[model samples]
Target: EDGSAAWLRYAPLPHDSSHSSLPSSIITLNSTRGSPVYTAQQELRRGIQGIFGKTLNNGTSSNQHGAIIVGTAQAYQKSYGEFDDAKELEEDGYFLSSESNQVLIIGQNERGALYGSFDYLSRLAQGKLGAVSYVSNPHASIRWTNEWDNMDGSIERGYAGPSIFFENGFVTDNVTRVAEYARLLASIRINGMIVNNVNANATLLSPRNINGLGRLADAMRPYGVQLGISLNFASPQTFGGLSTFDPLDPAVDAWWANITNQIYARVPDMAGYLVKANSEGQPGPLTYNRTLAEGANMFARAAKPHGGIVMFRAFVYDNHINESNWKADRANAAVEFFQDLDGKFDDNVVVQIKYGPIDFQVREPVSPLFSTLRNTSTAIELQVTQEYLGQQTHLVYLAPLWKEILEFDMKADNRSSKVKDIISGERFRRPLGGSAGVVNVGTNTTWLGSHLSMSNLYAYGLLAWDPALGAEELLQDWIRLTFGHDKKVIETVTEMSMKSWPAYENYTGNLGIQTLTDILYTHFGPNPATMDNNGWGQWTRADKFSIGMDRTVKNGTGNAGQYPSEVAKVYESIETTPDNLLLWFHHVNYTHRLKSGKTVIQHFYDSHYEGAATAQDLVEQWNSLEGRIDVERFEHVLFRQKYQAGHALVWRDSINQFYYNLSEIKDEAGRVGNHPYRIEAEKMTLDGYRSYSVNPFHTASGAKAIV
Candidate 1:
């Protein structure tokens, strides 16, 4: 009821449902107590007991007639016979067969067996008990979640609470929560996690902390989750008492090699290192006048001997931009930085590019870097923490948004170059590729601060494994497993979740203007002024008449040309660009007519009102299910819904008013600046509060003062 179990709740099925056909006994061919196969057996037993209310007998039975056999394909072959089905499985892949009285769960490896058990359990928990057989293989090899949890118990961009992995500048001594988190991740088929902030601390490389990481890894090892860490690029000089941390320097390379060896000594199956360097004040090879490839390869070489990969971030950009320059765009940074370095990286290094060229905006063209890095392994970076999309307070299902990016055809060499294919190492024909989700889960029992927000996390893992899955189908499965089989619950949650991304985009930022949030600090609420007039190149270019960033090759920053020729041609022209991203590709007058037949400013006004209205509707829909679900979860979600409804209004009014005051454009519907039902805060009788002028007054709906 507290939502600690998440989708793994395994709540009892309806009394009318039949359990007679379910397998009676569980058998594990590999009896290694601490292995993934053993974990699968334990999980199967737990799931069977919870769902059917019957504890099945464990151990190899002489009669395999009515038993579930779970093990690696090698083990199964040794026990029964060679499994032809194993050939179809890739790494961490499995086949689940319940075709007869006996159920066979075979995996390519021990981890695959564990994943198979979870998949089987998910189907059972969802009440899919009819005979079925299928081989499921992961779309990519590296499926990971990057936590931005700091060692001081604070999480950067994490909204839930303090860090569960660390406290007072060290990994936490107790890893009970870490193990629980690993279980939840394993259920969703997430194989790895980076437990520290990408803006890393050098102290994490300390001997004491390395030992602590071993403990954390041990706790998660049973669940088949490998551990990774974010490294501070200057760790050699800062933490190891070295003179230089230059990538080309032999001393620095030896320092990193030694430290990597030390880490592997403690945690043998370490997934890898994640590095965010030369961006936003982080130190990198750029500091030493070396290329990004050199920096990445240095770590890649160190981790290679231990079979670990280096996830070098492609979020590098100049923090300080001259706003007055029309051609300086941050959206061009990734391709500008990494395109020339295409075949230069070590095989074990994957360039982790954000889905967008900029930060995780509500809407962005799939980073052109996905197309440019053909010779280099690439993984799309997605944010599950909702840093820019209302930070989990609003129910924004990101699957649709991610699906759009994953399925977007970049037309690389005029071929079927989908983002998913490139990241899966299929189109590019690379060895290592996948996705890394920035899921800054904190201490909240709900895992992601809110109950509905967990759906995004659920869909993220499922999509990473298989990008072709429908967003709605994934949400429905999660709804059934987490909430229950209530038809209305499934229907209503789906409606709200499906509409959430668009609704959030409407109120916060429209027509690819980026989230008009306070970019300088807390990325919350509407602060259109903060978006412009700053060094950060996430600009709107709004003035007296025009709004948007002109990224066309002929006219502006040439960002539109970053895409492959075929894709670039579409974005390069205003007429060809989709209306949804019109602003991103061109700077237009407020009077410019959209493909929707509405003037630019008028569409802004209408969409804000429409989005806020939808937020209110979400509240009403949830209220309809008050009695259908538990009071604990119902009340918890209702509180967030109510807050979202109110905040959405602030977003709507502030954005509409800010643009109205700038462009002097009135809404065609006579809604902007006309709030007949509104009461001015300054008109109220003053108590402890006094009317004060709001600096950057557009943030307060163009109001002069507030009490």
Candidate 2:
């Protein structure tokens, strides 16, 4: 279990008995036989034993000294006459405070009590329990993580080890890990989780798999985490032996209803279904020429009877757009597909849209669909996996990227509307708005592939619970809890994490251009030449004279026109656009001057050099903390940092050389265009290069097969 505990390591306090102030006795007020409240009590005992090396008594008297009390508002009111102010909280909200001789943890309901227990334990773990007093409520109704895990035990974009939910071709027999996974999620107040990939397999609907899901739900029930599933859109036809999957077809509706009934009969508290349809060869309503809403409503109607909901992904876009059509932009597809269907979906259906219009690039404009669907509920989809950010090799803190998206002013409703407000249902006054993170945790002891990368997972849940939390402050708490309270360890980890994303963005892509990585293979490393003439709609369109897609409204793909008028106008004109997004909105010559007064090519050269140097510095800083943390984690992190430092040079050189050769532009510093990088300077593609040379871990044979 060297890396298994993650942030819940619960190491003993560093100071003497003076700093050890946590109570030794505990009393849970709830009398529910075997509910989530009982789970909370169990967690408190485990955390207490790990932290203080003491057993907590369950039936401590109220007059006893140094005892902790936990219960629902009604339970507390009936016992203590409502003096603790628990009744003022929302359903999942909790109140925590330390009184004279007793600590109080009260909640509005059972789930709330579970959250409060975790919060109290976290405070103790961080040594912040002395004067704790707060009423905490999540910003969204449902904070969920989609696993993208398959029944065969392989995760699609997973950098971690194999799946804990499955092995071979079905759910694992001994599901001890399932309960442990639920504990981690519950501690972060993440209410819901989908256990399968959105591109689901039809075989999961078999009676054997149905029973598998029931067992999975049972494992998660005690932790207060609701289990959901990702549905194969063509299941009616593929799994049910139906003739057609047409949404309006009576046979399809009956098939889905019957399946839903069977599932609920097994797992009574099943959450719902998540579907990715008509995108990337996934079967959807478009096959039958029906609207997306019609397809989503079909599933929603079936789940409504069981008090469930459906999360229909808005990630639909044709991957096979002809390369000849310059106006065919993937960034424009989501809004076009979903905008007309606003207010058309059933009340139980939520349109889940990705954070950006395009796939989860390092930087892109927020999806216009957030503002377009005024009458419908929308969830912002974020990628917690490091698919586009070095795949857990580099330490990239995603809170910075997520914060930019959450704080963006979309100008929705012609007013001050931020993405967070829109997704929280404040801007649209609709229910069912929240967030979903594409979580990539597997059976790896570190949870995520790298130990440092766990910060992204922690931040996703913390921010989804409350977007107002400071990214740096949260990182500090995580550092204290996970790595212990050594001052040097805290400072070193904080500095490394805070600067990670900017450094990554600097080396990979610049000026609002997406990460120039290989999309066809692993979605990893710098492959600038791979962008041109691709049918994936992820084109850079770099040629002899200019670079970037012309997405302007006047003479381009008109993707800028999808935004609100205020945002659209800014991106429509090069003179008014920000330097960061200059390329994203307009095609620019290599010499085009940015707001920073540097030519586009020069800025690219400087940023790449700067970023590469910063990556090396990160390795040095982490090396300085050699004896400060656990030796096992220290050595593992050092290996990753060393790998990142060396690989960053590959990214910097490959990208700089690709552009320099194309534009025939010399680097002002004269460092680029000097190295011979095994490239056919004429072809610009690395077709002859081996994958082992590109990334140390991959083989040429394996990479080509995927591509």
Candidate 3:
């Protein structure tokens, strides 16, 4: 009820549902204690017992009627004689079948078998117990999550609580929560996890910590989750007492090789290293004037010997950007840095690119780097942590946003090059590619801070496995498993989740304006002034006459030119650009008419009020399910919805006020600057208080308030 179990709750079905058709017992071909097949057997037992309130006997042979046989295809063939369908399974692919009194779950590999078990349990938990059979294969080979957890028990952008993996600059001794986390990840088919923060501490490479990492890996290994770590690029000089940490330097390369060897000795199945270099002040090969590929391939060479693949982040950008320069765009940095280095990287190195050109904003065009780096491997990096999207205090399901990016047609060579196919290693024929989600789960029992937020995590896994799954369908599956099979709960949650991202984008930053958050410090609330007139390139550039970043190639930053020619043409021309992303690519006057037949300023005003009104409606919808849902989760979600409703109004008023003050335009509806129901603080009676002028007047109505 507290949501600690997440979607794996396995709550019993209605009493009227028949259990006779379900398998009566379980059997595993390979029962090695720590193996993935063994884990699948355990999960089957747990799920069956929880769902049916029945403890089926464990059988040794497939001859037993109503037996569920689970194991790798090799094991299945050894016991029951032949599984021709095994050839059809890719790495981590599973074939599941249930007919008559027998059910069989077979995998291409042991990990695949484990995935098959979870798939079966998902269907059973969703109350689909009739006859079902299917083959499920992941879209790509590398499905991982990057946790921004630091050594001091603090996650960089973490909202939930303290770190579960580390504390006081070392891995935690009690890894019970780590095991539980691996279980949740296993259910979602996430095979790897980078445990430390990308802004890493080199102390994790110490001998003692290496053993600690082994312990963490051991905890996750049974569930088939491999542990990876982020590396501080300067570890050789900073931590190992070397003369230089340059990638090409023989001593530095040897140091890294030794360290990688030590780590693999402890954790033979270590996933690999994640490096953020030469960007945001992180030290990299650029310090020694070496290429980013030289920096990445150094780690790839080290890890490649141990069957590991490096995930080098493509988020490199100059933090100190001069906003006055019309053509200096941060969005162009990724392609500028990596595009020319294509095919120079080692085979095991995968360039991890964010879904957008900029950071995880409310809306952005897909990163042009994906199409630019044709000869190199790639993976789309997504944020499940909701850094700029209300930080979990507001409801925002991001599956739709992710789907838009994944299914986007990059038109590489004017062909059907969807982002999904490109990352799956099928479009360009790369050996290693997939997706990485920045999922910073802390100590909160809900995994994420909020109960509803887990849906994003669930959907991330589903989409990584199969990008073609519909967002609403995935939401329904998660709802059924997490909340229940209640029709009203499913419908209401789907509506709320589907409406959430658009509603958020509308109130915060419509028409491709970035999330209008306080960018300098806390990335929360409205602070339009802080966005511009700063070193950070996240700018809106709203002045007295016009708004938006002009990223067109003709007159502004040539960011549009970074994309392939076909895709570039659409973004380059103002007439062809979609209204949703008009401001992102063009600088326009306040009175510029949109394709929607409204002036830019009017659209902003209307969208804010309408979006806020929609937020208020969300609270009403949740209230309708008060008695139907458990009081604990109901009140928890209600608290957030209520806060979101109030915050949406603040967002509306502040943004509208900022633009209205800047543009000096009257609202056609006369809603701006006219609070008819408002009572000034100076007009109200005060006790032990004095009137004070508000600083940054857009934060509130321009008035002297009683303090």
Candidate 4:
């Protein structure tokens, strides 16, 4: 499959399949003209054709066998009687059931039907559709993605080459790639997308570009996807040709109203605006000494007229005061900024909170902002791009990390207070209009840039839809859909992906010092030496005998107080906290003993040596499947795996050598710092990104540079 189709890859099932016992009758309750409900009708027909080699009907039929009935809950209430009502469904949710004879998928709205459609296909594809006998209401209402691609075709933090929606300096006229991307998102029940980078350029909202966006909106319409765009905070002056861009200014409000009108004129159901304000030199209401709410509320006012919402990012920080302490905690900024202004937001504005306090690190505690934003709606942001997780080269499925963040209980004011329930509006019972916005950018034909990596994207969607789903279950489902029905392929790739996070953890940062790498602009490759120097909090605090940042309240950065009483009490003490996150919130010595009964330095030595060794095992494992998969895909992944294996050794050796030098501790195995061999200049083929100049689309050389 080569990962091109993502989870939507629907190969025709063999004739011997027994799902043929499904009923022949298909029916629709109440349908609309080309709405999301209509899209579900269309998709159901397409999926049935691929799966059973039979066409499904849109109108009612006497034969209830294999019949699929879909409608809004209201329509079903009027006709078939909703087993659940609006109050019961909490405004928007879905109820679905299908068996040997009758099948019904009803949503509270058209979009929900579309979601139900994809959920049904996933079940069938995973061979679990026949087992479902329950109605499901989603916990989180906002499932979204942010495409950090500029109209000039450059994708920020994107390893997959340029923006698929952009070529040259303008939006692409060739939109085939854009439509396919929409299908991939819709299959995962992703309902919203911001079409540009957070470092938004004012030029994107110009008439010509909005026209291009209209075309994209139309293509994505059938797939039940809505297009949102990032708004430059100074758009009032820059985009509208105004004298000032102040949120309180009447002119600024009028300018935004005009812009929103112009956008909706072409694509009436445009999702909304995503604003990155007061961060990274971006303009914001803070320039006027107004709260962040003022900046978001201004756009929220404009969007309210059109039934849209404004997603204001909570990822704000300035390194201006960064020189003050040995540890400047960037991880505490979000809650510090937004917690006090919780109830100040307009109804149509959702505070887009990053999962962790710091940027998308390999491992971080859940951001306290999710609990702090009580009145304001919130959407959790995640990055599917493996910026720090070895770029796209290493196979890392991020659902495990995401699951931890989503399921983290903040115990806000109530006991069942988790970040997921908070953002979902379930725990706090507030209105949550925004969804999860993931950063997954790559230009490889597969979209995410790798065959195995598609599982992360797939799992992100499933978990966003239903946060309660097990990470391993989601991984297994993705393995089946993306790679097909091969047992060996399923088992090997699944085992590898599940173990990948821990493996990456072992070699990179034993106790959360973080994968020591340079983080000035791009976050990639091993340079644990540079981890402490960057403006980030990755400092090991290493000296003669000590290592790690001390984030405890009594003797350190006082960041532990950010958590609720429950988590804070546990994390504040070194003995009670998990060993995996030791260095993250605490600064200890090499002599410190972990709960596992191993010394801190020994854990580092063992994990790096073991992790690198496991990477070699990964290559051997994948090599065993040489003839079992598509040769092109198998060989491509094998090449990358082999490279990662070698690179893992580099990570192991570099980290081992760095720590051993610092701690002056020897490996328990007596060979922690041993080098397998150093290659001569002629023997080392690691041209790295220098060799990647092949794809002109990706190369420093330009778009004509494919090797």
TM-score, model 3 to reference: 0.98
Off by over 4 Å in 4: 28-33, 57-66, 74-92, 129-132, 536-538, 676-707
User: What is the Cα root-mean-square deviation between model 3 and the actual structure?
Assistant: 1.3
Question: Lowest summed lDDT over 10 consecutive residues: which window, candidate 1?
Answer: 698-707
- The regions of model 1 sitting more than 4 angstroms off are 59-61, 686-696, 701-707
Residue by residue across 1-707, what tens digits does model 2's lDDT show? Answer: 36788888778877763344567788888656557788888888888888777788765655547778887777877877757466569868988877555777788888888999999888888877577677988798879999989889999899988998887778777778888888889888998899998979877888988899889888998878888999998898887888899999999999999999999999888889999999998999999999999999999999999989899999999998876888889899998998889999999888999998889998888998998999899899999999989999988999989999999999965799999999998888988789999996888888888999988888999899998888998899889888999999999999999999989999999888899898776789888777767778888888878888889999999999998999999999999988888888889999998888899999999999898998999999998998887689999999999999988887887788777878889998888856454443334455664323234212121123122
What's the CA error at residue 164 for candidate 3, in Å? 0.3
Off by over 4 Å in 2: 17-21, 31-34, 61-65, 675-707
lDDT of 3 at 390: 95
TM-score, candidate 1, is 0.98
In order of listing, the candidates' clash counts read 0, 0, 0, 19
TM-scores of the models, in the given order? 0.98, 0.95, 0.98, 0.91
Q: Between prediction 1 and prediction 4, which has the larger TM-score?
A: 1
In angstroms, give how far residue 53 of model 2 lies from its true place: 2.5
Return whichever of 3 and 4 wins on lDDT.
3
**What lDDT would each prediction earn against the true structure?**
0.92, 0.86, 0.92, 0.77
Model 4 C-alpha lDDT per residue in residues 130-150, reported as the tens digit of each score:
545456666666778899998
Tens digits of per-residue lDDT for model 1, 400-438? 999999999999999989999999999989999999999
| Pairs of residues clashing in candidate 1 | none
TM-score of 2: 0.95
